[model samples]
Target chain A: MTEARATMPPGAGVVMPIGGAEDKLGRMTILREVIRLAGGSAARIVVISTASSLGDEITHAYLQLFAGLGVSDVVGIRPENRDQAGDAALVATIDRATAVFMTGGNQTKLATVIVGTPVGDAIRAAHLRGAVVAGTSAGASICSEHMVSFGSGGSTPKFRVGQVSQGLGLLSGVVVDQHFTQRNRFGRLLALVAANPGQLGVGIDEDTAAIVSASGRLEVKGRGVVTIIDGADVITTAYTATGTQPLMMSGLTLHTLPRGAIFDLTTRRLVSAPGLPDETEPPKVATLADVPEDMRPRTRRIAAEGAHTTTAELRRRPASS
Target chain B: MTEARATMPPGAGVVMPIGGAEDKLGRMTILREVIRLAGGSAARIVVISTASSLGDEITHAYLQLFAGLGVSDVVGIRPENRDQAGDAALVATIDRATAVFMTGGNQTKLATVIVGTPVGDAIRAAHLRGAVVAGTSAGASICSEHMVSFGSGGSTPKFRVGQVSQGLGLLSGVVVDQHFTQRNRFGRLLALVAANPGQLGVGIDEDTAAIVSASGRLEVKGRGVVTIIDGADVITTAYTATGTQPLMMSGLTLHTLPRGAIFDLTTRRLVSAPGLPDETEPPKVATLADVPEDMRPRTRRIAAEGAHTTTAELRRRPASS
Candidate 1:
């Protein structure tokens, strides 16, 4: 089940952007693909925890999940501020990894901590050197050239309700939003893209992932759809609408891609049907029993806490829900 | 082209909710239909100006529009506060109208002034007595039982980001959001309905109308689509997700109805193909000259000022944009 993905020539790896709360436990379809793309069981992965505010727990959860899936060479890195983001030690960690996965938190905080630093450069370098790069939620958002700094939620694109920030430019000319359908962020993303017509809008629904091959083919994976909003033919009031007056935009095109759908970002068009070959069935869905016996109680405790479940618990939950 | 709509027996009229910025000048498809439904040349329409903050200008726009369409029997009424909303004079004006139209502005202010007042009661009474009841933008929002009080815009639905208030309750078991696709409000409406699963979510795109007949048939009209979000099978974290964490939801169904589509609100199912007979071509799109000679300057001034164009200019502007 292994491939030479990790040793592929520079500029050939994939960038996977996940809508938040991806199905980590049942069928681990997206995650297993991440591992296979990175280097299967031999993958050396780096988990980026700068976007997360919950600290090391988020990092630890990813480590456990990867280990349980048989990838024990994974490590986590956190560059707390611009100063830490410049740390050579952190850059080295990213440089050595076959894959880099960013956890979700505050995208603004993530960009503020690392956007222009050495760690950010290392990430770009890793992608250029054929290492798969992936991010979930906030992590997913920062993989593009432009990122949503923050905004209000609604169906209308009111004036001044949203802000934009720079992202790590691993993928360009598109603004990516995670937790698409679950969060209902269609408006804000439309507003941002309307304001900047050069960039297309990519919205990923939770439990879904859009894997962008270096060839510009974006394939949808997992349970939900990836919505692409193209503003090329738009006529919008994004420039002149005053106050809370709703922006008037006509001619924008929207394409929703479900599992196995492929889109070409370079041409800004939906590719013909029949996307890349589907991955082999996910390595069997791991249950709580698969967690190291020592780590079982911790997983149970996180679930008991109720409101926020760590990645470890989410990865081991029963499939029915 | 006129029908005996206004003279129909009690409880047999329609409620038209127009997403804001319905074209007034070019095509005038929606506004013309409003006139035809209200009795065309014989109609006496009441303009409810409580939702607008722009003094009488907003009222003037509609009066001019309907007049240009040959319905000269229109009057404007403004209930500035709850006291005015309770005024018997205002109620009497509503009592005599063949149709009632509420303009767009702020829903909260509109509701604060007239939600349970005599004027509001009179409008409802007019509907029951076989008169058309219609609203646009903020006015459109108040047609539903649960109105969005105030909220931010984005794709993700965060806790406390949105608040709902009582509307005119002209339509129940659903919350209506206007400027749907143009405004990108899918998330907030989804959140509101996710919390109150008992209520279905209806989002109307700008320049569009959803006309609910007394028979519980909702027909789509105008240029855009009406999105119906049904959460009957939803499994969500709306009740438990902590601050800023994206709510997890699954099994929600979304149906987008383009112009000419019909939906059965009672059964919450899309009606079969072959909707109602289409309306005749609109009385020629009104040009600026159709406006009274003296009103042309104000209309031109509103456009020349840029940024914000009055409804009059919006109505008369050449339709190509």
Candidate 2:
């Protein structure tokens, strides 16, 4: 059925990692971007509920969320174990998807179940062909090559206090951690980067997303800031730090960016964000009952500036010859 | 000259590990007890300031505190490196002392500088021969076989989020952490115990001390509570948890104890605290301005009960033939 509809957008290799608990209701900025990147109303989104412990609950939530956003064709593929992850029908569903989203739960369980299987391959193939790939929380964490398996968050990085596992490899040479600032996960992410100094550590705060394009450009979206930890110049005592001791990590560069910020991941530099709509009408928007309580005045300013990309705007197709 | 004075109380094999920042001022309960354990004014105390980064500052502070508590023969030994730790005169001073106290700083540096030196051997020898061995903060941490070198603290134990290093081994099969509650070090201690289930994890809150007697009976002293983590029954997924992922640690037992509580470490059971002084006098004690502000009503109640364990009481000699 999917093959019959030959108008599918060639995958743009877009990846959006939402730092768990992104706003599902008001504005739904991050989620809407997922839909927009996947070709809006014409999108065929496949929700991978493999990481979710809630079983059908998470899958149903995404399916309903996309449907509410005016996307009619959305489906869910849940594989409980490796055997099911390789199912031909499930792999086919991934192949047909213009967007693939993995929900949050346990990254270890998710990777263990599908990483080497046919479903994982299909997801990668779809991304390679230009499909949008996005995830939330554990799902977001698994998008990187070196995934943070589990660890407690703290202010100081300790030696070997965290565990790292292989991930889906959608984002190479990167470590992604969701619910960053909210959970005080700076330590864990920094530790991961210190352990693997060559990798980039991208930490997305709650309600935010770091959207990476095929061109290696990353743009911030949603209400929260994205923290980037660059360890290229880090001089760490991680090698000599014995069990649970705090590590001495010096000279690591950190960048904290909010919405409308553009970063060039390949060049390891910040690309100036395009001029956003004028931000002078914040107080008036704050008085509007429709604005989310969690969305600060700054976010409200963006909303008032007409920076919102509505479903109608997303549905408009690009002109073709 | 040391042999001529000859009134050393035979070693009591007492090991007191104080969480950092014990009160040095009004009603110094913890420090006074250290003086009492070391035979009051007649005590010959050796202060080891190897862990301190502030040089003479830490040593001077300890010397004054001990002197104020009526211990006159207090002397300090500052070893910046392992070579200094092996000094013959320093080892000789430890040999003649009735009690040894280690000051706080960095545990990793302390252990690295002294653990294998002659001074380290003398500390163990002094402890074995019954001299009271006490330490605070980093000093307290090095009493165990496995020391928590450094790590950030959190509520959940993640996979390898902490580092562990070798310690002085004064308290076998144990790991000690100072400023436990004050620094929120519960997670690191739990992670340490989860990694080495055979070792007992003792987390002493600031201003509190866990005094382990020769018989392995642990008595709590001072204002703050002592957190004991027993992981012998813990069911953990640490073996398989890759990278900084939170571990599934189940069935671990936790005991939070305060002053006057007694515990048998060997048997892992609560040894009923000797009837604590009546708690009825708390209101009157709270009204007394002489008491420290940080001392809670419960601690004041004990203080009013004449449970002060005065230096005069310690100065009384044991009846000898």
Candidate 3:
């Protein structure tokens, strides 16, 4: 069925945002999905671990794991500096890759190395040319247009959870946070979205992945859930609040997409899946009515922005499409 | 110097709750610390992958990683089922281990396997005998008295963030949340603390570890900061409110301790570290007065409980102690 979809967009690659602490051993749930999206075992794979200080170890570990999984051609690279990131040979290696896996480490490190270098250009270019691009933890954080560089830590967002910096920009209109549930990063992601009210916040849980097709199709797979924070219609008192006070906001729509749930970014709704969230369950549009009274006014603001559908929309597309 | 600390507590081992996605390749900041605490290269390390569904793969990954690190004796074991968790041989391996490491997987799977069986008994016994016990992600979740098995995913705590069940109970008066900063789990951890009221919530970040000595001495290390939420004195309307309303609580003392920060659990204070916030910088004790007006009252409740020191206490002990 996936192959039969001839209407799929060009330069459309599957964007997989993995929650951190993935099961890499025998059942590489997320990895296998990446391989599947990249056209199976015959695909050329490149594993990048620039986010990791221990790059050699991550690269070698993937080398053996991918080999064990029967992928014939796999290359692992960890550039020590920008000069290495700009190497032409490295660019060539990435260019020919069908899938790219960025390991967990420091998001800043990964962004610094590949953002504008030859290697970085190759990845963005490859991703645009229908190659599957996957990242876990920091790697996942760098996948969005505005990556969260650093932030304040806590359950609720303070004045700042950290800063949002330029990311690889493979995915637009959204910011990504990895290891979502395992780390409980909802607040920081929300803060990021609140600061940049136009963007959606996608938080992927551990051992899970949010797979986004180039054509804007999304499916969540694995053990955890994907939290979607739509701040497009939020109204917050952040602009008036001073330091040390709790942040107050309204109209933020949040959706928790469990494993097997399918989402449509374009339609802005959770849709029916052939294998999961089957046809019987009617599609549910994202709304604020379900939220507590205090948070409704702000959520209602977003409703005005997207009249038919809001964040966390679930729908069952007609089978014909 | 470690041996010279004759005042060390018996059956007291340091509990390292490493946030998930640790750097296992070359410089395993957290793992190396576990090794050092367990007597370095000479220690008998037992790696438990039972928490992981992909036990074989995780076990193998750790075996190679540990071996690469040149640890002389390392054993990896993944119980195929619950019954195997009681195997005498498995118990024997744990008994001889100077350090035990639990890999990441489903916290529920791990709890089901090791909670009641000899495996759990062996782990508790190992820690009691001063064996360094460490866990990441799911492993870390199981280290607390109230394990956060699963919860609502987001930045703020909504209706109960999932549930808390029985854990290994290696650390008391505290609940552990891993991948803290990376995942933005501050709210969930706070919810756990708010529910328990008396338990301190320790949220460790990715690539970082919170080290607790047998003598109850505490220190923060690695690249990220440790978010310590003391709920011993929270004032909230959780009891008055019902269902899905945003959780309202105050006087919940929050401390973000970066690397090298020393905390005295017994004193409930961030103690003196010669160079930082130097002598001119007065110690900051966590008080209701310190918090905004909303949180002051409940935090004051904790002060009534532990008169000597309370939330965010930073006092230099008398020089002659």
Candidate 4:
């Protein structure tokens, strides 16, 4: 059988750095990048925007952009209700689109409105069919399989703890955070990665984009760098009430890629690609298997008798007497 | 066996109304209520304030309150390092107190400073030993068993779709949101409840609190009401690509309790309590067992396959390939 990774088709994903909406240049750059990824022009474009951002100004800008590109058709999905059927019109529009764009706003609202609706299904289908899909700010956030809900932020890793939220799994096995450096969301992202080691953390700075292709290759674009937090090789053990103290983690990989670098998601490695700047040395890569065995979580095989004994002990305890 | 609920001691919980800093009188009322629940003025009191709120002026106020009540010891947990282990001292200060009060500041900072340290362990230990730990604003938020890391605000029920951050699980199996009514956080809370049916949702309005006892009795105090969202009885079907659709949730219950009403968590019922205003009608309650069977997820039973035609079909497909 063909490998799952190998079967993934080639497609384009555009990320917008519009968290700082004060700058029109940033928005324009994002649009330009989307167009570039869509091979200069897209035939059918679908806009998935938040209700708050669906006002006249944003809509007018989109209309002008599409018109400029000589694109005649555009679909806008604004989920006002969170119920599954709330975005029916949007879903129907997405069904026949060639490109999808998610706008910024409350990601929770976006997820609530679009998720479980026909629109979500259509978005996934379009992406699978090799259509370009893009998101900005909160939109960029939900693109990852795992998401970082806002958390307390600080420089210490401890600040990063206990603040994680689930995300739309458009890009499976990955976590995305927007307004990265400008907002100082590093501690929260680290906390997210720590909580879920198997997932990759992608932090896109303002005015920047981290576009990943269907073939599992990630390319960095925009004004700032994209911070990639890979925990494939981490050994973490801590003073947990459930057990031991002094948690140890080793072999975690972190990469700060500026515009023009490519990362391979499947093999968990970095590859050379167009647009990447030359580096003195290749980026560091690590996997969990590379960590020392003692530091890893112990895998115990217990007999049925032992399990019974544990349960019996609990059962044997007198109620209140 | 003795009933677990019967033997359970009175709940020792922390209530914070600091988020209502804008309303000093309201904050004082909440503090007074906390004092009442802790069994009157003679109870030992501890004030845990952040560096921002730990200045001389605030300390003087804490001192006056403690002195007036003949309570001793008000320590400030001033972490020298806002980004690192600076909050360790604060956590340690909370360790020795009977009741710990986490003052208001940047919740993200407070969480970052306290999570995964000796202080965090001490706080947990204090709770286990029946200490009251209360926080207002950001402080109130971290008091849940599954803390809200910061979720998107919306009133929709989409599967695996909203961003959620990790929170301190002081009160497990529940989601607690502060500034509830004032900020109109009901929509977000509802969406969270829908996404996680097994988890209870509790929204504490500013200047108010839902004082939950060790025996699982939750009593309301202060000016505003507590909105309790219970989704345990919902009937949901596969909504994601990996599952079925049309989630049927029938037995979910929602309760808005004003000051003085008590809710029993063990029985999942509400009972009238002192200090609350008289209600026109008793609050309705719902439990897991009340959910209809069909609304529940369908269980797949294992079956043995013994069809020659099926075997032939599988063999034929492989041969043809």
CA deviation > 4 Å runs, candidate 3: A1-321, B1-9, B277-321
TM-score (C-alpha, index-matched) for candidate 1: 0.52
What TM-score results for chain B in every one of the models?
Answer: 0.81, 0.81, 0.81, 0.67
**Per-residue lDDT value at A198 in model 2:** 79
Residues B1-321, model 4: lDDT tens digits: 112121123454543333344244334676766565545655556655553345556656766765555555555554534344445555566666767666655566666666666666666677767777777776776666556666543222223423345555666666777776555554466556656666677777667776766666777776655666666654333132122111122224555555566666555555654433355757544455544544533233212344343332221122223
Q: By TM-score, rank the candidates, best first.
A: 1, 2, 3, 4
User: What is the per-residue lDDT of model 1 for residues B1-321, given as tens digits with 9 covering 90 to 100?
Assistant: 111111223375799999999998799888988888899899999998888889799999899999999998999998899998988888989999999999999999999899888888887788888899999999898987788887765554556756899987878777888887765676677678668777778889889998888877888788766777666765555676556544444445555566666777767766632332233545455555665543345546565766442333334444343
| Model 2, position B6: C-alpha lDDT score | 7
Docking class of 4: incorrect
List ranges where model 2 is wrong by over 4 Å: A1-12, A273-321, B1-321
| Per-residue alpha-carbon lDDT of candidate 2 for residues B1-321, written as tens digits (9 for 90 to 100) | 001110112344799999989898778888898889989999999998888888988889889988888788999999889999999999999999999999999989999999989999999899989998999999999988788898986544556767888888888777898887667675677678778888878888788899998778888898766767677765454565566544444445555566667777777656654343343445332224454545344556566666654421222223341
Q: Could you give the DockQ of candidate 1?
A: 0.11
Q: Distance (Å) between predicted and true CA of A103, model 2?
A: 0.2
Name model 4 segments beyond 4 Å from true: A1-23, A39-42, A51-57, A65-72, A84-88, A159-162, A238-251, A273-321, B1-321
Model 4 chain A worst lDDT run, 10 consecutive residues? A238-247
Please report how far candidate 3 places residue A315 from its true position, in Å: 53
Q: TM-score winner among the candidates?
A: 1
Ranking by lDDT: 1, 2, 3, 4
Comparison by DockQ, 3 against 4, better one = 3
